[model samples]
Target: MDLPNTEAVGAIVALLLARTKRGDGMKPWVRLVVPLCIAVAWVHSPALAQQPAKDPRIGFLWSGVAEAAAVRMNAFLEGVRGALRAQGDHIELVARIADGNQARLPTLAAELVAGKVDVLFAAGPAAVRAARAASPSVPIVALDLETDPIEAGLIAGLSHPGGNLTGVFFDFPDFGAKWLQLLRDAAPKLSRLAVFWDPSTGPMQLKAVEAVAGSMDVHLSVIEVIDVGNIEEAFRTAAKQKVDGLLVLSSPIFGSSPAMIADLALRDRLPAIMLFPEFAQTGGLLAYGPNLIDLFRQSGTMTGKVLAGTAPADLPVERPARFQLIVNLRTARTLGLDIPPSLLIRADQVIE
Candidate 1:
């Protein structure tokens, strides 16, 4: 016969013997009942109640097609994944793109939250707003934003982004002056230029541009292009006004369609200075902006912190550590504009 569990048998016998010794002092049923209760409690101990943790889920909402912004977005997410791997944390990343439609972001944000993502990774200001509106408790990491999140009221402040959000700020206000100056260097004859911007990215960022352009003998005219479809007209209007070049601010609407914007600038022979390297990569003449890939990587770093139990409020928002000046020599040659010696010397990268 199989041996009885010696420990359990011993426990039961001890209880029975104690009861026998007590005699009528204790009820007979107490011996039968107490032992069984102890056995049951032992079977369901704290160790048995514990479970392995589930992998975290990260949801990404972007303002443009995933393919369009893949270069920067992939760099950002991969950076996060790399950090997590070192710490033995695995995660699921679900990315949704708005494809240039802002209205879709709210619904997409709701879907990600409903799907039970532990944190939301937003690609732009619009996506960040949507994610914040959808879930109050889920942590959010905003990436590659041109406008200040604090001034825009997306977060309480950079140091303490209070309600479940923190991220990388692109420092647009200061970058604006640099971009204008670069455009002037590339096209020294540039007297008047058209600025393509989204008004919602916080009131006109014209102060920096105005200040820089005023001294350079350059005139500025602002044009609003909330919809991607109006991009052509925005360019044509600039051409009609006899503007010498284009300065397209990094905004949700413009960032959504880099290829289209680049093509239009090429066809129109407009010496364009854009907000990110992707513009110059696609065909634009010049790009003066922060290193967006690094910002995305930093966003990943922040997300990893969130996954590791660090609250978003406690993690301060970071700024892009570096900026890049990319000049496309091929496009310059195509447009027949000789790249200035100053610009060529300063360019971090010159795409041939």
Candidate 2:
């Protein structure tokens, strides 16, 4: 029940005092009840009424277009909803999408911070960096596929972040080597390779590919693709170079357009491999990488923890719990390349 207002309590006490003063045969018990009533009114004062808690707002920063990121976003929302279900707390998401433009991330992140979000969720390394720069105190949960958080100095350590940032990060350098080996296993005669890279994602994947290309006796024609606009040109450059195969490196720009890249690879008859399983599923020859949807969901769950009063410093950094290898036999046949039985057997999914 709501407590009475100060004015109402004052009026009731004033009425009781007037009755006592009139002395119209009032019982001794009635006089005693006057002080008790005053004490009760004092205890239930309006000043001590409980205020309703404000709903928590989460800032979402993404480096890709909304349409391309829809599935992942849905998965993240599902995870957040599941985590907060027991608490019965409502969450409001304030999203800022870069729409495939890297330059706009910092401004978007700043805007989210300026809106006074309780927690921030950033996807991709660029978005994460921008969110960190925009706010030093706001807790951040990130989903980054191409960065080593430790090497990048985004956190003090993985086990205990020691700061206001924690998220799912992929160690792309070590994972990059696996892409080359898988491609080679599918196309044993691959001698010259074209590497489609995005500089914005960092040099880790490129360096890893370079380190292994020579040992495998393959010549590389590295093509730098800065945005979606440059993807077609990159493919054309690879075709002109007469490279035997293509290795598409990890980047939000490329990750957001798996279908386009896959179509280009098929059009150019280039046996290609990328870090997104959607690439192979869409038409590319092979894809081996962490499950992006699951990773985003994991980040969402962590964000819920931050919203539930746990400090970001106490939440440990995480990696993608699931990895997948997808192979498209139809794409291999179109390129006139034979995918080894050994590779096909190892794939988690094979599209005929």
Candidate 3:
């Protein structure tokens, strides 16, 4: 039941007191009943009643294919549900999937913003860039693995974003170099290495690998895969170069097809390393990097904060706290390469 307006209640109370003070010839029952009836009518007045609150709407912008990105989407939803459960709040999710088409992100982001989402959750660098372009004021929680938010001028710093954008980011260049080191450990004669890269993810990971190639005495053959169609050609080029090993950098396109990439690597007899544990689990020789599913979950938690009235500028940017090294002994044996015992001991999981 809605309470009467303060002004109306005060006026009625004042009238009753004034009548009593004036000693009006009215029965005590009549005076009390009259005021109670007026108060009840005022509360039931339509103009004075409070309206119900609308649920918050959250926008999800993804650059990967929906069918292939199911696990990541589920993890993110779990986080959002967990965070909002405490407040007994419900949210309407408005998702815009690019289906691995980078060009469609801008239009999809614009549509989400026009739909009036309270907060936007962007997956991958392409989607993040599109969301920022579509709305300058919308709160954006990003899950990006390929670019440095600071270098890209997306945020002020890690501790304080100082803008309407903040979430999980993987910016450590050395982390890319570590993938190369792991590949070398699995295949000691990794002289010529093929780098599978997606230009849309920016050049952070590619540049990181390039910077240490000369020092490591390794020659790099960068094969850019912009579209899903280019994946097969990338492997063909790697085969033409007769590369000893492959280093698959981070990108939504590559992340969406771990099994396909692993199968191709095995067919080419290439010892390969990728940044997702799923790649190694599927058949790739080695995988070492942040857990992407957990990173998406973290982004969802941040989105929940935004919906709970926390400004994006006040929320601190975060990095993936947990990383995993996965080694596939079956794949190593299939490639005729023996993974070092030292490397296997450090692995979080070893699949045979």
Q: What overall lDDT goes with each candidate model?
A: 0.74, 0.81, 0.81
**92-153 in candidate 2: lDDT tens per residue?**
67676776777878887998899899999999888999999999999999988888888999
lDDT tens digits, residue span 1-352, model 3? 7565453321121111111122433211101111111222345567756554566777888877656655665677668766675653345666766667788789879988998989989998999999999999999999999889999999998898999999988888898889988888889898999999999999888888999888999999999888677899999898889898899999988888888899999989899999988899999999998887888888888887887788989999888898999999998888888888999899999998
> How far is 140's C-alpha from truth in model 1 (Å)?
1.1
Q: Which stretches in model 1 have alpha-carbon errors above 4 Å?
A: 1-52, 86-90
TM-score of each: 0.79, 0.84, 0.85
The C-alpha RMSD of each candidate to the native structure, in angstroms, is: 17.4, 17.2, 16.9
Clashing pairs in 1: none
Clashes of 3: 0
Question: What tens digits encode model 1's per-residue C-alpha lDDT throughout 53-157?
Answer: 565778878776444555655576667765565553345666666666666788778988997988888887678888889988888888746666777777787
Q: Which sections of candidate 2 miss by over 4 Å?
A: 1-51
